[model samples]
Target: MPHTNPASPILQLRGAQVAYGQIQAVKGVDLDLFAGELVSLIGANGAGKTTTLNAIAGTLQLSGGSMSYGGDSIAGLPAHKRLRAGIALVPEGRGIFTRLTVEENLRMGAYTRKDKAEIEADMQRVYELLPRVKERLQQVAGTLSGGEQQMVAIGRALLSRPKLLLLDEPSMGLAPLIVEKIFEVIHTVMKQGVTVLLVEQNANLALGYSNRAYVMDGGKITISGSGQELLHDPKVREAYLGEIA
Candidate 1:
């Protein structure tokens, strides 16, 4: 299991709800993430996992409920403010800048910061973590393979030095081997003191790397527990792990 601080969570959500016009996406969901822990939100397609993540990242405003980060209410904070406060989201579909070189895309992650020396240091660190990105630094981001683009996307997020990293469907549309590599990098991020909330469709893989996980169904959290607990759960097995009960 991943090590987690017993102190108050770095991120907390209570009775959170999000709506688009008359359609509600996330409903009354509560979650907590302690420092240095890797937590996952897993569900079937359209279960509101992505919406919940967006709410946390301040990309999608919550129609109801409250969110607190680092003990301060952030319901009114904008996405850029949230990013400055150490919240970074690597959205699904690998949102890389197609027109930019790989190096330029990575540099964009630090646009909020003026700390030139630290930024360069962080850039070096990212290169160490993702050497493949270094190899294609001058290459156009759009020309990279899916796996490489995903790597660049993650490296870009890490450049922000986030305290809370939100990843949505990182394993989607990648080869199995590449997916494994991505998860390995995520684990490394957690070990370096970043709290991670991952939204994944791969339940087994998510649970395997998670310290804890929540099961979302129809915009509500149906169950939550330690990773090992949910991994062996009969319901989780039957529904997500392709196991017959």
Candidate 2:
């Protein structure tokens, strides 16, 4: 369930914009994410969903507008600084280090933290959540299957102990069962008090898990509603859910 009480948003964006040379990817977008809510940004390919996530993660700089996290302006923060500030991004394509072992990959997420004991406890939690990743701990990450790699990618992000998790296309290029498993992990993460901002291509799945959702078209947000509201919306159904109106 979404948080209903009035509280400051964990993250807020006002008129946020991004560009690639002259090509504007995200245009004047405003978004808010409250603590402990699962929010989804859904759209077709090239609709600027990924760009929005990147901008929030500090991987890409905004050409215009303002962004704040935890009530503090962070438009000028760098990617590593954002990560250290409890914002972790599981970027598109997993972004795992191919040559590293699974354990090494997971360890990389905790690089910013110096707390050894807490890190080990978090690693145990990840193993419990993803037993397959534990089984592949000694194996090279490059040799893992797509599903396993995705697990590793998620587990690595978890090890960061982030307050906000930015997931970009986490369901991409995976089997149905794998996608289900990935969403399960996301649900568990949300239950554990981590706020999630998901950019997903699967509208039905994304909305099913989201507390609220936004629809983006051609670099602009066209609709916003509760997950259930959007799921039943005629326009949303016709445009994104493959349903005839």
Candidate 3:
């Protein structure tokens, strides 16, 4: 991992809260993402991990609290503004335009940017990271397998040239081998200077690859530690890791 400045976080959330009608999904969630670090949010269904990401991406508004990026307040920014500010989100479902070719989908990701040459270069870089995507670049996105679609989603997010990448359930519903490949690509993305905030159901994989992790339940963060520490903690092992502590 690259040296991250602890004093300055790339993304910061203080007492963040999100609600839907009568139910609160994320309550007073305080989180930080430092530059060049892979941070994870691990939790069960309805744990609010996805909600947190949505709030940060500006798709969902925070009922209370504040969010800042690089010391500037982003609380009122819309989703497009946030994307323009270098925050890109690969949502849970691998949202790609099914009818579009892989290349078309990738091109859409760079819509917010004006540098055509840089965008093409970034697309090539993504192809290097995911060769399978390159092989299927001219194919329709819907014709690809689930794993390939996931790659397209990630590749699209990369094309945005984001400072912080929010990945929700990148490994969900994929085979073990495909998941491994995705994780490998994620590490590569981090090494290339994009900070990642991952929300995943696979606690073992998340804890293994992340520098730090947070456990959320009941709409709030309940535990946090270094990845290794959480991997070995009795409570974490029992609850998230499927180990009978």
Candidate 4:
């Protein structure tokens, strides 16, 4: 059986807006990511999907409203400070350090931690989850295949031992097989008790993995519902689910 909770949200964005220069990429979106749930965000290319993730990660300031994590307002916190507050971002485009070795990238993820022993333990656990990363620990990131690079990116994020993991387009530019593998790894991570906020252009995969999903378009969220519910909605079928009939 699936899990259910009536508790407060672990992460909440209330009436948030994200702007770029003169363009408002995200307009007044409200969302809650509960503990032990995977919340997927899906939309078209320019629909502000990445912008919302950026806002939540503190890369982009909210033009309005507030963001809270675990009941503490994080609206004013910087990106690094948010990480220390237990938020980790596996950014879009698989933003790994191409020139650095895989082990070096993993070590960089632990930069904010002062507890050396715990960091080491988490690193080992990350390797256990991604044995492929362990094999390429000393290999330079630039030399790894695209799928391997994705693994490294996710492993690096997990090394931080964050309470909330933000994944933006984690399935982008990968083969179908690799995409399935990545989703499986995400499930494994969630099973270990981390909350997830997933943003993906591949709506089917995102909705399938998430317990609940939010659908965005033209800088606003137009719909929100259970993953399976959205998957079967007629409007969603015509729009994101890719059904013409």
Candidate 5:
């Protein structure tokens, strides 16, 4: 079930904007992510999807508007601070350290944590969740296939034990079967109580997996609805689903 807590939102952004000098990538966006719900933000290239996620992840500063997490303003918090506050981002292109072993990369995820025993336990849990990761613990991250690298990236993020997981393009550049496996792992994570904000180009898959979704165009959100509603919407079908009608 989707998170029904009416008292507070896990993450909220109002009038959120980001500009790179004269180029405004994300312009005056308003969004809310509730606990225990999988939300997708979908759009074509240059539609500001990545910019919005970067703002939420604290990698980019917002030029306008307010952002809050768990009802407290976190506008000035650094990226590491946000991680400590239970927000973890699995960035696009699987940004794992190519030189590091899978085990070493996973350990990097818990760098901010001081609980040795708990971190160890979490590592074991991740291994169980992704058996392929466990089998290649000593392998260099760069040596793995695209799908394996993705698995390691996700497992590393899970070690942080985040309340909200920001996934940017997990399905990019993978074979169809690989994409399905990645989505399956994501679904498992969601069921395990991680609120996910997924940014995907695969509209059909994103809408199918998410509870609710937002459509972006020209740096602004143009549509918002339940996943099923958007999936069947005529405009969405034409623009995102590649329907001729």
Candidate 6:
């Protein structure tokens, strides 16, 4: 486990609200993420975890409240601008370009950077982190297995050199072994000074791997506590946790 300071949060949200036309998905959710930490958001279907992450990544506009990154307001910034500001999101379903080769997909991740030397360096770094991706460099993304595709998605996100990585369900549609591998990569990313905000359906995996976790339901955050605390909560045990009688 990495040393996590109890003080200082890297990103903070205050009374954040979001909507899609007439459908309001989030209702004044508050969250805090610190540097070099892995925080998780776990809840059942329609819990609004994805909506919250989309708000932070600027993929969706916030209807009310404020979002600050590294102590600066970025509410007016667009998604690409947010990417330049050191934020990257690996959305759900491993949003990889199926038509592209694995290596080409990685290249697309660094499209924002023009420095050839740095871009190549990042490619090598990602390959080192996920050696399987190296073997499939020439393979088409759509042809790869579900787990392999997820690795490519994560590697692509890392190419952005983000300070904050917003991942929505890195463990979806894969075997337990594959899920473990994904978590290992996420741990490695945190060590590289890239904070991770994970939204996962697997409550057990999320709580076990994160320092702290939050639970969302009915368009609101209902619980926020240390990972172990939430994992041990009576209600959490019955609902999200699985050690029931």
Worst 10 residues of 3 by lDDT: 1-10
Candidate 3 local lDDT, 169-215, one digit each (tens): 99989999999999999988988889999999999998899988999
lDDT of 2 by residue, 1-245 (tens): 55553899989999999999999999999999999999999999999999999999998999999999999999978999999999999999999999999999999999998999999999999999999999999999999998899899999999999999999989999999899999999999999999999999999999999999999999999999899999999999999999999
Q: Tell me model 5's lDDT, rounded to 2 decimals.
A: 0.92
Give the least accurate 10-residue stretch of model 1, judged by summed lDDT.
Answer: 1-10
Per-model TM values vs. the true structure = 0.98, 0.98, 0.97, 0.97, 0.97, 0.95
Cα lDDT of candidate 3 equals 0.92
Which ten-residue region of model 2 has the weakest summed lDDT? 1-10
Q: Model 4 compared with the native: what TM-score?
A: 0.97
- The predicted structure with the larger TM-score, 1 or 4, is 1
Give model 2's clash tally: 0
Could you tell me the lDDT of residue 227 within candidate 4?
88
TM-score, candidate 1, is 0.98
Between the candidate structures 3 and 4, which one is better when assessed by lDDT? 3
Residue 35 displacement (Å), model 3: 0.5
Tell me how far the alpha carbon of residue 57 in candidate 4 is from the true structure, in angstroms, after superposition.
0.5
Count of residue pairs whose backbone atoms collide, per candidate: 0, 0, 0, 0, 0, 0
lDDT (Cα, tens digit) per residue for candidate 6, span 170-205: 999999999999999998898778899999989988
lDDT of candidate 5 over 1-245, digit per residue (tens): 23355767789999999999999999999899989889999989999999999888899889999999999998988899999999999999989899999999999999889999999999999988899999999999999999999999999999889999999999999999989989989999999999999999999999999888999999899999888889999999999998988
lDDT of 3 at 57: 97
**Which portions of model 3 show Cα errors greater than 4 Å?**
1-4
Model 1: per-residue lDDT, tens digit, 1-245? 64557799889999999999999999899999999899999999999999999999999999999999999999979999999999999999989999999999999999998999999999999999999999999999999999999999999999998999999999999999999999999999999989999999999999999999999999999999999999999999999888999
